[model samples]
Target: MSQLELRGIRIQLRSQSSPLIELPELTIQQGEIVVLMGPSGSGKSSLLHWLVGDSLPEFDCSGEIRVGGVRVDALPTQARRIGLRMQQPWLFPHLTVRENLQCAQRGTETPAERARQLQACLDAFGIAHLSEQAPDVMSGGQAARVALARAILNQPAVMLLDEPFSSLDTATREEVRAWTFAQLARQGLPTLLVTHDIQDIPEHAQVIYV
Candidate 1:
């Protein structure tokens, strides 16, 4: 099972002497969700970016990021096996739901296998019926599911969620939040969720205050 490890994490703006966030170490085990809770500007998102190796140049970050015991902090964003889902779905405007997901998958599998895999992911997200629909035509929840499907198709070792449910209506937010956590757990992903809302915390989840 793959686990995510962060060691000696520290982040600060280049012009600032005080660090915004500092942690000696943190570990997210397989099938676990660790919620990072803090108000806005608390460096929750910055920490995630550092783990993915995409921290803004204006920020000074130092950390040892590892996945399944393999160090990956030195890798580029695309090379690090990390999945990120933000508040916005960020789907390509012109692509159909199916097409958007298709672009995230990469493998040497045959065409038929690839199609099957894509279809399975869509079904798991409860979005198979909307496969041919455009993102513009879908509800906020539907679009979010498609975005998550695309992320899952990428098959990352660790998942990072930056308030992914914050944009949805209350009902939709509750439903989608449950589904997302369940799905990620089923995949045995080491997940770190960043959110300011206490309601977003799942039962039994490990929460860290920033």
Candidate 2:
């Protein structure tokens, strides 16, 4: 189990003198989801980007991001092992569902083991039947689940979710949200979820009002 910690975080947009966000300390406990609430332009997504080592150079970042004892802010995006899901699935148009998940794996394991892990994610998402289908052919909910599975297969030390369920319809949102929380709980990873809607905050999650 690992905790995600941020210390003395600050970010300034391009040409802006003032920092948009100035956070002194934020720590997400192991196996818990921390819900981040703020208005649309409050730099919530930018904060997540900084943590995952994906923030643009246009935004000056100052902070220490740590997962367990390792300083992830010093690592490159690929080496950070921090998973991120966004409003858009952004599944590759050319890749099939199974291939999308398989390609996301940083396979130190044998090919057979990697394939097995892919199959497991497929079965877990109930998308094993749709494994060969293109992402465009799937429904919105399927696409979201597939994208989430791919993110999980990335095998991060922590996960960042930015309005992950906001794009879905009412029924689909409820379904995906429940499934997502269950999966996150089962995986036992620290997760930071950013959403404007209060209803999206699960009962067990910690709320960080920004």
Candidate 3:
């Protein structure tokens, strides 16, 4: 289990002048789900960007992002161990689901072990049958599940969700949202979910309004 804490964080975007966002303090314990809800341009997405060490080139940020007690601001994005799932379900159009999972496998020793890990991840998300399918052939909900499976295959310390459920119909959205949250809980990964829809949140989440 891993913990994530943000202390005295401030982020600013530089154009000619600076636009800033200040956050007092926030903490998310291991295995907890924290939802950040706010309207567009309220700095919700920027907060995630800062945490994941992928703040846009135009932004200037000063803050402390600690994951499992390690200061991550100075670390590279891959070293941050944060998994991000965005609304677009950004899987490669050219890769099969199995290939996508393979891409996220972090330093598994042997080919067989890597295959086993990928299989387990697909099974966990109930999409093992779709492993050979191309991304374009999968349904929206299925693609979302594959995206999340790929994210967790890396065993990230914390998962960042940026309105992942926004693109589906009500029924599909509800199903995928439930599956995504359940997988996060089972993996015991702390999660930060950013969404505009309150209805998509699971009952167990601790919500913070930005």
Candidates ranked, most accurate by lDDT first: 1, 2, 3
Question: What are the clashing pairs of model 1?
Answer: none
lDDT of 1 at 29: 94
Q: What is the lDDT of residue 77 in candidate 3?
A: 93
- In candidate 3, which residue ranges exceed 4 Å CA deviation? 15-20
lDDT of 2 by residue, 144-176 (tens): 989888999888879999999988999999999
The local distance difference test score of each candidate is 0.90, 0.88, 0.86
In lDDT terms, which candidate is top? Answer: 1
* TM-score computed on alpha carbons, candidate 1: 0.97
lDDT of 3 by residue, 69-151 (tens): 99888999999999988888899999999998888988846988887888878887899899999999999999999999888
Which candidate, 1 or 2, would have the higher TM-score against the true structure? 1
Off by over 4 Å in 1: none
Each model's total of backbone clashes: 0, 0, 0
Candidate numbers, best TM-score first, in rank order: 1, 2, 3
Candidate number that wins on TM-score, 1 or 3: 1
- TM-score winner: 1
Model 1: weakest 10-residue lDDT segment is 46-55
When summed lDDT is taken over every stretch of 10 residues in candidate 2, the lowest stretch is 49-58
